[model samples]
Target: MRTAAVIGTGLIGTSVALALTRRGVTVYLDDADTTAAATAEAMGAGSMAAPESPVELAVLAVPPAHIGSVLARVQGRGLAHAYTDVASVKARPHHEIQSAGADPAGYIGGHPLAGGERSGPLAASADLFEGRLWVLTPSAHTERLVLNRALELVSLCSGVPVIMDTVAHDRAVALTSHAPHLIATIMAARLENAADESVRVSGQGLRDVIRIAAGDPSLWRDILDANADAVADVLDTYAADLGGAVTALRALGSADETRRKQAGADLDDLLRRGNRGMHAWCGNRARRPPVFCRCP
Candidate 1:
């Protein structure tokens, strides 16, 4: 696209802006937090001044809860020819926009499967989405032009586009992204009251597991809340696994030899399952999906 507007100058928005700017797209940046917009602009992501006319596309990088209203407000003003969002949750915003009576013809829900523990424009990078999966969730009412514009955006950002239904997208992220963050947070929280001696013996495994736990909590709160049902379903399964693990650990101390032996087998099973899962995750990363072409 020749010109584009990024409505939220936070990490994803600014990073998208940076990528577009690098590709010679004229990017106009805006945010509720003026400092964020200025920071993005100063970092050369985009111009902070409002666009004099409608751009080819607009990226809404706002929170999931704000998507509907923000979309309504922007569509009301004829913000862009086509619009897409970078928010993680899709179903919530999709319904909200529909309920708000906003036109879906020019809008598609998107989420680029990349980010860091850090946030804001300062943490943004032009290559943040490089080689990552960028999901496109087009409503039944979404126009072909809107989908094409979003695919072009992904291509410009050097991301792979994967089309998915909104509900499936939400469930997938809940398992792959949302639950993992909460798991890390729960694991890391134990360190808060942990004896220094215990923490002092920490290793790379501990750090790696808890690294994502260091993300912005307020933002996480909104994300988790936005996809609570799906996340809860994931957590429910994990909770069962956790309970099993605990029972096995405690069984290891049993007086009965059979109980102790069974516990050992249970621990081994869990560890092996985790190893297999990791292997599958790694295996998938080496395989790239077919690239979609840019719009004519």
Candidate 2:
């Protein structure tokens, strides 16, 4: 595209602007905090304000909570010919736009499954979305041209494109991302006031499990709330597995040696199943590392 506008000068927004600018697409930037937008512009991301005329595309890089309203305002003001968002949750904004009687025809929903543990424009990287999955959810009313444009944007960012309905996208993210984030938070919460001795004993296993716990809680809370039912389903399944583990461990202390041995065997089988399942998920054969590069 010739030109684009990026709303919200956060990490994702700034990164997108930088990528587009690098490709020789003129980009205009707008954010509530004008200084932040100016800072992004100074960093060579884009311009400090919206273009005078309608841009070819507009990327709304705002928080999930503000996407719908911001999109409506910008589209209504003729700020862009077509628009898309980078919100994590899609269904809520999709419904919000429809309910508000905004033109969903020129709009598409997009989510890039790429980010760092940090936030804000300073953390932005032009290559943030490279090799990552970018999901697009288009309604029946969505224009073909708009869909193609969105796909082109994903390709320009070097992202893999996946199409799904809004509900399906929400559910998939709830299972794969939201639930895991919450589980990590729950694990880390136990160590909040941990003594020096206890924290000093922490190793890679615990660190790995709780790494995502460093994510912004407010952002995650909004995401979890948007897809509560799906996240709840994942949590329910996890709770069932945890219950089984507890029962098996308690059974290990039983008076009967045979019963205890059976319990131990059951636990061993469960652990083996977990290992096998993880390997399958990682596409590992015989627990070997995934082949990242192939010889010519």
Candidate 3:
């Protein structure tokens, strides 16, 4: 696309604008908070002023809750030829937009599976989406032009495009992103009441597990709200696993020899399963011959 408008000047929006601008696309910037628009403009993302004419595409980078209404309003104003949103939740917003009487032909739903523990235009980077999966969800009513525009946007941002049904996309993120986010939060929340001595001995392991817990709670709440059912389903399974671990731990205190042996086996099984899962995620390189540490 030759030109585009980014309708929210937050981290994702600014990052997308920066990427498109770097690719020589004329980007128009706007946000409900004018300062955010100005901030993005100052960062060389795009012009803060209104575009003279409708751009080739418009990206609604608002929160999941606002996407439907924001899209409806922008399209109502003839803002662009085609539109897409970067909201993490897809199915709900897609259906909501349709329910709001917005034209689905001109819109496509998208989510870039990349970000940091930061928000706003200042935290945005042109490379935020590099090598990351960006999901596209187009329904039967979606127009080819809208889908193509979104694909171009993803390509310009150096993102890998994966097309999925809206519902599948929601479920996928619940397993891979949403559920994990809440897990991290729960782990991190433990630190809130932790004694200073305990927290003082923090290690990389804790940091790694709780990294995403630093994300804005308000934003995460909206995301969780949108995909509550899927997230709850994931959490239910996780709780079962946690209960198994607890049972194994309590069994470690059993007076019976058989019970103690069974507990050891259970713990070993869980650890081995975790190792296998990690190896699966790490792919072929994990199976390669390992080089031992050579430090003398």
Candidate 4:
């Protein structure tokens, strides 16, 4: 791509601009916050000036709720030949775009499966999306040229392309990203009133569980709201599992031997289920066992 506009100068947007600029694409950076745009420009992400005319593509790096309105407004002024977004949610923004009467053919849904807990222009990095999966959701009306432009953008950012339908994409991210963030936040919230002695001796497991809890709550709120139903569905299973674990733990400490014995069995089952999950993917394991270890 010769030219493109990145409409948000925050982490993902600026990172995209940096990546594109590194690859020799003329990138125009814009943000509602002038300081953010200037910061991105200073960091060598891209130029803050508006494009002379409609460029090759416009990447709307705005919040999920604002994508449609922003897209409609930009399209009104002929912002680019094609467009996509980096919002966490998909269906809502696509619906909003249609509602706002933006041309559907020139747009596609995009979400790069990469980020950090930190945000804004200061946290931007050119390699943030490198080697990560960037999902593209193209509708029946999406033009091949528009899809090609988006794929080129992903290639420029060193991301692998994965095509999915919009609804499936929303549900998948809700399970993997949205629900997990909420779980991490809820877990981390336990430390707010924790004793210094308790927190000071924390282990890697505790740190890992709450790592993503540091994300900006306001931005997460918008993402959760956009994909509320799907996230709720995933959280329901977590709630059920949590309840089971609580029940088993309480029973394990009961006075009755029979109850204690049954509780031990129940807890064993719970731990084994998690063990299976862990066995499925223990990051970067060099060799694989023929089968999962069944012994407890």
Clashing pairs in 2: none
- Candidate 3, residues 85-154, lDDT tens digits: the string is 9999998999899888789999999999888579999999999999888999999989998999999999
Tens digits of lDDT, candidate 1, 1-296: 89999999988999999999999999999999999999999999989888999999999999898989999999999889999999899999999998987888889999999995989899999999998899999999999999999999999999999999999999999999999999999999999998999999989879989999999998899999989999999999999999999999999999999999999999999998987776666657735323331212
Q: Report lDDT (CA) for all predictions.
A: 0.93, 0.86, 0.91, 0.91
Worst 10 residues of 3 by lDDT: 287-296
> Candidate 3: misplaced stretches above 4 Å?
284-296
For model 4, residues 1-296, the per-residue Cα lDDT tens digits are 89999998999999999999999999999999999999999999989888898899999999999998899999999989999999888999989999998889989999998886989999999999988889999999999999999999999999989999999999999988999999999989999999999999989879988999999989999999999999999999999999988988999889999999998998899888888777665432334544544433
Tell me the spans in candidate 2 whose CA falls farther than 4 Å from its real position.
284-296
Clashing residue pairs for model 3: none
Per-residue lDDT, model 4, residue 264, is 91
Best by lDDT: 1
1 or 3, greater by lDDT? 1
